[model samples]
Target: MSRHEALNPDDHRDLRIQERRDAALGDARMVCIVVPAEFRALQAEYPILFRLNETRDRFSALAMFGFENGENLYLADGRWDARYRPLAIDIQPFLIGGRPDEDGPKQIHVDVDSPRIATGDEGVRVFDKHGRPTPYLERVIEQIGELDHGFRESGDFFAALQRHELLEPFTLEVTLEDRSDNRLVGYHIIDEARLNSLSGTALAELQAAGHLEPIYMAMASLSQFSALIARRNRRAARG
Candidate 1:
């Protein structure tokens, strides 16, 4: 369970957050939700895919980290082995609260129950002795704000993809060096063929909506699959 509280200088003046990546800190995952705004950076390192929600009424973008559930290939030696991690992964223990479209200001909420919440004097302090925000806290606030904006803008991107029939089901089959087989299903990818065949007007519409670049970025990210497979093989060899 999570205990979330709106962050305030008074209540959390001495709170410190552990800045480390490990499975025990909830970094163990095959995939993490991503937004189109992050596609440029994420595409360079991870395979971008899409999955339907449980209700099947909405599609969410994903940055795949491994082939199996609870496996994060990037995580090793208590570190995330990547130059860039998705904003969703970076903003841990803190989240944006309240409606973005509302007139009221958005709030930053912290998960007090997270393991990243330091119990001793071993982590980065969120605030200074004068009750002012620390540099680390400022960075976290910026990250959370960007993530919130990206998440709100993602709905339009998904809607455009749906309207244009650009999403196609994808299944990946992997055979490791040891001859073990792995299969991944229930994911979607950009229909490159359909994208190529789109009418000029359709392309114009997508471009006008600012969704074209990310669409191509997502398609380009598929190449990362080979690197991911290599990582899996390396892990097996080490084992």
Candidate 2:
């Protein structure tokens, strides 16, 4: 359970955050929501794809880290062994809060019940005795702000992908380390055939909209599935 509230210096003067990377820190996820801005960075580590958010009735781009729910192959020895951690994973126990004033800047809020919150002098302080945000908290503010802004722009990017008719449903069948048969469906990715079939003018429009690079990045990232399979095999062997 997460008890989230807008962080203010008034009541949260003693709020501190424990910087931990253990599995309990909640990084163990099969899919991390991502924006196009992080696509280039995410592709190097995880296979990027899109999945339907049934509740929201929208398509969200995601970096697939595992085949099963709550299964993250990048986790080991209480650490995440990946060169690039998606922004979605990095920003935990925090979310962009809506504002009463429509024109106001995004506000940052913390989940008080989150395991990451601590006040035993073992982690980063949210505010000092003088009630000023610490440098670490300042960085968090900046990162969360970036995520908030990027998420809005990402919505338009998804719409553009739809406009160009580039996304397609994909299914994968693979044998895991436990010798169990797995079939992953209900995901979407760039249709290479349709993408290649686009006219030059259409490609130019996509490029002009700043979505062309990320599309290629997502296509290239499918190869990382091989890396993920190897990781599963290694983890299974050790067990």
Where model 1 places Cα greater than 4 Å from the true spot, the runs are 54-56, 99-104
- Candidate 2 deviates by what RMSD? 2.0
Q: Candidate 1, residues 172-209: lDDT per residue as tens digits? A: 99999978999999999999999999999999999999
Residue pairs clashing, model 1: none
Clashes of each: 0, 0
Candidate 2 residue lDDT tens string, 1-239: 87889989998999877676776777777888888888888889999989978896778888887888888999877778899888767767777787412345877888889888875777788889999999988878787877777787787688888888889999999998689776789999999999999999989988998989999999999999999889888888888
Best by TM-score: 1
Q: Give each model's whole-structure lDDT.
A: 0.92, 0.84
Highest lDDT among the candidates is held by which one?
A: 1
Colliding pairs, model 2: none
Stretches of candidate 2 exceeding 4 Å from the true structure = 99-103
